[model samples]
Target: MPLVRSAHERGITTLTLDSPANRNALSAGLVGELTDALTRCGEDDSVRAVVLTHTGNTFSAGADLRNPPPPEALVALLRRIVTLDRPVVARITGHVRAGGLGLLGACDIAAASRDASFAFSEVRIGVAPAVISLTVLPRTDPRAVARYYLTGERFDAYEAARIGLLTVCGADVDAALAPVLDGLRRSSAQGLAETKRLLTAKVLEAFDRDATDLSALSARLFSSAQAREGMTAFLERRDPAWVL
Candidate 1:
């Protein structure tokens, strides 16, 4: 079965990340599937808005520690999310981490449950955010990014919203998302497209200027000895040697 699933109704398309076993980790196949879906939605005039969500309690655990996807694959998926003509809304639940935070940052709008938590954990695993920084850095509160990026500490949904990482946090995430989606549905396709373009112009500029270098940096870090050890230790449920 495909790791990503799609459904459309009333001009709204919902694409769900469905690999619950790994908390919808962004494997190569999953990213490819998601990118393709987003591309299709961009082309479908009937799809006025798109919801990017997940099926399990854990929204996404970021990269697959055991078999991480290429940095280019993830970069491409995030870029598509940013450039897709329709409005993309992330309905976040459970917890999000590392590169998953990048996905959240690329969305035009995001609503997370009050109980949901987020973290930038690459530092703990001996790598930097690298390619994801292209999108996440622009969307996040600069102050919040400094602390969370370095400390690798988790923050709750309220903090996420406060930092501009999320549009809103609510006791019921779906309830919070309803009106946002409804409003998008009411927008003309061209209106949403142009508004999204205006909102993402800076991010798109960064992508155009920095994506190649960032992807290279990501590939190098992930292949480094320290990062390999960190990923291995994490998969083994142990601390990397660098951990004090």
Candidate 2:
């Protein structure tokens, strides 16, 4: 089944991650599907804003290393969300880790369930969170990011909101996000697009002049010895035995 699912109505579209068994992992095919969906949404004038959510307990558990995606493919999908003309909001519930956190950052607004937790756990497996670095690094507080990235520790949704990772928090995340959607509905699509463009331009400028180097770095991380070991261990249901 395609990982990306959708329900469109009244000029607002909700795109859902649907691979519940795998916690909606970012497989290569899934990345392609997401990219395609986002492109279609952008081209559709009726879609004024997008609300991203997921099926089951996890919003997303991040990438499935057992079936890894191409670095460039995943990166492009995230870039699309970041640069999309319409407003994007993440409706986060349950656990969101690693690449999942990247999706939250890419969106213009995020609302999390009161019980949800956010984490950056790539380091626990011996590799850096390269694919998510550009998005998460800027949006999250430096100290909070440092603690999580360095230790692979988890933080609750309220902390996520406190650090600017989420715009609202409530037991009913959908209810919390409804006002944001209403605000989007009241605004002009062109105005929203221009605002998003201006914000993203600032984030884009943070990278060095040779920003392609970051892409290269992500590719390298995917192919690294540590990543290989970590992915193998995960599939085997064992602790990764990597020498630091």
Candidate 3:
């Protein structure tokens, strides 16, 4: 079955990430599926906007440690979201973590349920959120990033929005997204495209300039002995060697 399911209505293309077994983690296959789905939307002139959502209670748990996506693939997928002609809105229905936060940051706008939580979980596992920083650091508040990136503590949806990780939070994410989609449906395609370009030019420049360096940093950390032991301990449900 496809990892991503795509549907269209009223000029809106909604791409639902469907890999719930691992909380819709960004595995190589899932990223590829997402890229393909977005490419299709790009080609279809009728697609006025896109909504990225997920099927599970967790929007994503970030990169699947057991079967992670290729660094290039993950970065490319994020770039695709930012560069797509139509505005990309993320409907975050649940908790988000690590690289999953990257997905949220990449979208032009994101709305989450009031109960949704978020965190940068990489540091706790002995690796930093290097690759994801390309998208996330640009959107989130610098101070919040300093704390969460280092501590890996979870925060609520309201804080996520306050920190600029989400555009809005509500009892129902769909309710938050309704007005956003309504506004998009009213925009001329050309206007939307140009506006997005204007909004994303800096982010696109960062991707071009920093993605390679960041991906390399992520790869190095993930392969380090500390990260190996940390990931192993996490998978084994035990404290890592460094745990006090």
Candidate 2, residue 163: the lDDT equals 86
- Alpha-carbon runs more than 4 Å astray in model 2: 207-211, 242-244
Tens digits of per-residue lDDT for model 1 on 111-179?
A: 999999999999988999988898888988898899999999999999999988999999999898888
- Which residue pairs clash in candidate 3? none
User: Over the stretch 81-182, how does candidate 3's per-residue lDDT look in tens digits?
Assistant: 999999999998788999999989899999999999998989889999988888888888899889999999999999999999989999988877888899
Off by over 4 Å in 3: none
TM-scores for every candidate against the unseen true structure:
0.98, 0.94, 0.98
Residue 192 in candidate 1, Cα distance off native in Å: 0.8
lDDT leader: 3
User: lDDT for model 1, on a 0 to 1 scale?
Assistant: 0.90
For each candidate in the order shown, give its overall lDDT on alpha carbons. Answer: 0.90, 0.83, 0.92
RMSD of 2: 1.8
Clashes of each: 0, 0, 0
After TM-score superposition, what is the CA distance of residue 208 in candidate 2 from its true location, in Å?
7.4
Candidate 2 overall lDDT versus native: 0.83
